[model samples]
Target: MGLRWAVREPQLGDVRSLVEAELACFEDPWPPPFFISEILAEGRFNRVLVEPAGALVAYLFCAWQFLDLHVLKVAALPVRRRQGLGRTLMELAERHARESGGESLTLEVRPGNLAAIALYEGLGYDRVGRRPRYYANGDDAVIMTKRISG
Candidate 1:
């Protein structure tokens, strides 16, 4: 999955919508247990963006790995694509990473996903490496990283 920025803490009620959004955005979706687990994963910093009516708009599920914040899954709901949500999320993620004493923000995306790649590049994340056959569909993953300034 590639996408999201969060404004709300996910609730048990938000899991199904998050799952649905994940299913909607990704060809190979993660199982519900991951979303379920996040509801109580206090040590983690993942978050969801929800509408005032409680609809899930997007989410950022990331893990702090050593000195870097690694974005595991990020996606906006299909209807909410563009309009700067991805940029907001990435900018916020970078800020959070820096505040948490991180040196970089990192993520992986499909090489064919030019829109997402463009977004990452526009945000200063440079392609640094590649993981061959990274997706279930056998697509190679392009690794991108942005160094955070204090």
Candidate 2:
């Protein structure tokens, strides 16, 4: 049988695993301190998908700003990609945002990240704008937003 995975709200103890996953997934990943701060910050919703053995395979970080929820970061371990964990994390983030009274959810993705762009688009996100040179490596960012409905 295939391994079963579960998603839950992240705790302080999961910071290390989350950071490790981030490093494995991103070329310019956020440092461990950033994960720590985001997980501990007020108005932030952090979720993690864990394997049966308690290894974190995916994570999503988002923050509620007034009526808007901003997706700060999301990633799945390389071995766990294309298995719907990213979609699951995004769904959880949307639900949390809606429950928090958010009217919309916004995120920025690199123009070169076709997989992420396709995922957001498939989830009903629309491209709203672009930010030039948004990344440290001079990649432009594509800004997308999805409305939250009751």
Candidate 3:
């Protein structure tokens, strides 16, 4: 049987597993304290998808800044990729942003991440700008934004 996944706000107890998932998903993962701070931040929205057994498989971190919802990170474990979990997290983030009176959602992604770019574009995010040599390895970052409608 396939695993059942549930998406919900992450709790303090989920930090270890969330960090583990982040490490598995990203080349340069955020430190555990970053996740902790985001979860505790007042204007931030953090969600995680977990299996029935309580193993965190994916997570999304975003924050409200003025009229924008900034997507700081979103990732799914390698074994759980391409299952629409990232899209699901994005939808949740959008809903939260709209509810909080955000006018747009924006994110920065590595220019070479075609799959992520396609996903963001498919979800209505347009390339608005770029940051030269944004990553530690000197890769340019593409800035994308999607306007939110009430």
Candidate 4:
């Protein structure tokens, strides 16, 4: 079988699976109810990339307002990391944001996450600012933004 993946709005049923994937990738994963709340909230966007067998392999969450798309979270399963899944999910978000008249997509990543910095940089995101003590352990966050003109 060949690899296949697609991004779609996350379902309530996928929260547990997404949390599992998040746990695999992060030392601090959001609780299941948090994902549920995002999915149920207005002006928020949450999507998941399902594998060939319908497993949740990756997820991206963002909050939209006016011309801004603020990416709140994203993660891929350990087995899917470095396999282009994250890039694909981000591209999907960019396309959606542009189509929705978003002027820019913004995100903050932990300063120590070199892999994520490289991924965002490679995808045309520039480091625009920083937030000190942004992460749970007081790690600084490198703010990045990619303009996707409407």
What TM-score quantifies how close candidate 4 is to the native fold?
A: 0.93
RMSD (CA, angstroms), candidate 2: 2.0
What order do you get sorting by lDDT, best first?
2, 3, 4, 1
Compared with the true structure, model 2 gives a TM-score of: 0.93
lDDT of 1: 0.81
| TM match of model 1 to true structure | 0.90
lDDT of 2 at 83: 91
Residue pairs clashing in model 3 are none
Candidate 1 lDDT over 7-97, as tens digits, reads 8667778778888888899998988998888667755667777666767788888788888899888788878888677776677788888
Which prediction has more favorable TM-score, 1 or 4? 4
In model 2, what lDDT does residue 35 have? Answer: 81
Whole-model lDDT, model 3: 0.88
Each prediction's total of clashing residue pairs, residues at least 3 apart in sequence or on different chains, is 2, 0, 0, 0
- What lDDT, from 0 to 1, does candidate 2 have? 0.88
lDDT of 2 by residue, 71-99 (tens): 99989899988999889899888888877
lDDT of 4 at 90: 87
How close to the true structure is residue 7 of candidate 3, measured as C-alpha lDDT?
Answer: 78
Candidate 4 runs further than 4 Å off: 1-3
Global Cα RMSD, each model: 3.8, 2.0, 2.2, 1.9
